[model samples]
Target: MNKGLFVMALEVSNLNKRNVYLMYLIIFLQGFVFYGPVAVIYRQRRGLAVSSIFIIESISWILMIILEIPWGYFADRFGYKKTLVISNILFFISKIVFYKAHSFNMFLLERILMAFSLSGISGCDIALLYSSINEKESEKVFGRYSALSNAGLFLASIISSILVKYSLDSTALLTSVFYGIASILTFFLTEVEVKNKNRINIKLCIDFVKSSKNIILLIFAVSLINEVVQAVAVFLYQIKLINCGFNIVYFGLLTAFLQLVRISSAKTHVLSSKFGQNKSLMIFFIIITLSCLAFLTLKNIPIIIIALALMCSSSAMISPIILDIENKSISIQDRATVLSIYAMCGDILSSAVNVVIGKVSDISIEASFTFCIIICFFALILLCLNFKGQFFNKYS
Candidate 1:
């Protein structure tokens, strides 16, 4: 549904409508990073080796892994609005730190701040959004919510095509200003009513995951696909672009095209509704699998664009449906915490896959893609293994 039509049909409070639109604006602003289109090259030009950048990222990932559950617990126990308000401020601070950073230690500080900021907001944002809307609208709302970030990136990439020509530092500075504005907006968000639950903590989240067989299976299967997507689309695409003789100056335009592909996220609800969640997920997973196969065997421009479209479109389509399915398993009282647990498990899988893919990529890009193909196949196998009648159908 269109945004205006959705609003007209909402049957929700004015405050709820405000929360939805406000969050859309906030998420879109968060994606307005001028440096994003050229993150690795920008870092390299700022006096750090690619290896050092990876090390910083590894540390940042580890830190977020450590913090995700605790932050979720905080959101569940206190309030989502409070968590968002705090985390968005931290997010802006991290962007400012990035703007000024040139040395490795300085960059590490930025990463550390980002770890705090990102982990704190991990599942809280979605939980808040899910709370504010009617359940039937979840898919449409989440789809558009997912797309707004890419819409921002689409705009940023256009700006970056201009900005990277001048100063990379300017990209970070401009990005910080948008983030600072977003941070302030969080202060005005209405908090969803959180149920008072006892002993909300990391241990509780751990226990919940351990016992929820369906959720455990779902998270593992989906996370594997997400990791491969991040590796192939985000990390490897840049390298492939360079290997194919694309110059650095055109990186923004190229990445912008990918973001344009991701904008298909807004239509995810249609796919999931037509195919059913499990079948929809399987179809998209196969799409990614074929795209990886292309990476392993083909390198022409048309093939490159086709493979990218396949991967990005599949990824965009999958996220909101996955979020919607996962939320179905969560109780209202533990929504934030359980969602964080889902994120943590996904991160654990991602961190491991990233380390292996990084090492493999150092040997051969083809070899790295081969590894991604295996992950995709494994994910497909997991998807097949799911007993929809037992797991998904119950929720449906």
Candidate 2:
């Protein structure tokens, strides 16, 4: 390469680092409103039943699945930066609604708003970041991004623990402020120029499907791992803590602990290199399987904590590896749409399964955990089949 060309590339790399830093800041500010600790507790305090809460969450995922592609199309056609700003605005509005909500119906409305906002965010954010840097750096970049986002959650967890002790409403109010700040930060995001700026249409969709079908299949195969761990198990673990006679005030602290574990685990390459990505994924699946068993068989706090650590570690490990595969396999112009399709797999599963999980939890928490164990076993089998067939060879 010419010296001048090399210098220009170096300058662009430096600029990309700056943009990534801005993204980190936005992620951190949004983390200040950490709702994970308060999510179930907040609904219970508002007089909604557990099943009702799960139904609301399921509805949210349903909306996410419905709106994901459209919002992804918007990001591709309009602008990732503008779409992100709109998403932040929607998040702010949702938080305000959540703060003012007194009835189940009111909370449902808030979740609907939230789903749309998150739909706009999930695909576009990753697409923007991946586009900003060299393709080879995407996995490393996502690892750093996940770590910083976890750090934000860790800090927020401390405040959330204290705030929830005071009032759930207070947490909601502060969360809204965080979203407002994050929205402002989005204005500073550097937009990547797309070479093929085509409008979304049937032909485009068909092309995406044809090109990404294999990766999409693999994505669906691993989707259960994510849904079972993050969407289902974590919430149940909170209920488990409450059942074990722990005070609600400690929920935020517990959430923070998991975030710490995730922070440690987000550095993907070391583990992937050591075990190989395929074997590493197998290890994570086995760990999750074991954790599900622990929840079913153990009641001691120490055992519960160990199980949660495994869950968190596996959750962190799987995301970047899978994301790198999905993101790198697609074209820049179609990145958001393809990634949305990937997310839609997980959302579809979570939406369908949460209601059943909720009802089972209502009947028996152990039964719910048992149900998860069965799903994990099935997921493990699917993963094995994929690997044995060399499904991920192309990505590797």
Candidate 3:
């Protein structure tokens, strides 16, 4: 047997098992971030001002955006497993750094590490998973892939309810410990061999992507909705809860509920099979638009919780569908690179939305949600455009 083909030939069963199981386990472990509920409080306790923290986050986003394509290229050129191993190591190191960080600069260092780690993992992990599984199983695998992370996050948020009241440092330490396990798990992942390992031609790739923008538009549109829902959930929901006189201590419980709703991502394949992809996604964006609208106007807690659940469900359900579409639209040779570019476009827009949301949030939470409404409208429009042309008859 050729040395390069040994894993594929002799270890077919093991390769199939390790790639899927390890990725799921790694993602779940990575989600055990005990500091998730108290990230802001932890930073404030460490003496960083809100402005400085936002600045650091923005810088990290920028760095991640800048490195996204390059990291993807590296995964394509070198190997996916190597990239994931290096990325997981950096991710664990970043967690450890966060555990020890006290000053603004120290926290900034952790973000810097994260930008590199996350950028590398973005396209490579999916590319690896997509390669390992039969095409028919993509939906179930991707669905479970998404749900398990929420499961980890849900469990972590529950633990955070107690851990936060006791010790923030311990919270950071335990989070890092889970991340440490994630790093080790990456070592067990089997790399699916790339069909084309030749050096990428930059200009040719650019022209090719330009020609394929329609299929790409699907993820871009979904990204807009996902980012808006995510920003609202992470940044502003707490304020809304507090304004309604909800106690801060139960925030972890509230967060757990949100994560619980996100578990609906695993059911999206069923929804897509029932309604078809276009209808299911259209329904999601419509739910998002209405959710944002209700969140803006309603004072009723039950109504608000229902709206948030719809938004979370919409956001989670769209991801796997978009990913399936994206993977089908690309050739195996350039899959990781194209996916990274797609993700980069989404990140760029996310940064813009975050800026819009942050600025408008300072003015009023209502204004921020209003901006999300406008974004959802555009996303809904783009989602329709994705399936309209003759091009998608080929990819769709």
Best by lDDT: 1
lDDT of 3 by residue, 177-287 (tens): 999989998988877777667776555555667777786677678778887887666666666766777676777777788789999999989999999888888888899
Local distance difference test, each candidate: 0.85, 0.79, 0.83
Task: Order the numbered candidates by lDDT, best leading.
Answer: 1, 3, 2
Candidate 3 lands at a TM-score of: 0.92
lDDT for 115 (candidate 3): 92
**Which pairs of residues collide in model 2?**
none
Q: Write the per-residue lDDT of candidate 2 for residues 123-211, one digit (tens) a residue.
A: 78888888787888887878877777777778888888988866778887888888788888888877776545666563575467566
Candidate 1, residues 52-129, lDDT tens digits: the string is: 765677777788889988899899888999999999999999999998988999999999999999999899999999
Kindly report which residue stretches of model 1 are placed more than 4 angstroms away from their true locations once superposed. 1-12, 197-205, 388-396
Please give the distance, in angstroms, between residue 179's alpha carbon in candidate 2 and its true position after superposition. 1.5
Clashes of each: 0, 0, 0
Off by over 4 Å in 2: 1-14, 210-213, 231-233, 391-396
Q: What TM-score quantifies how close candidate 1 is to the native fold?
A: 0.92
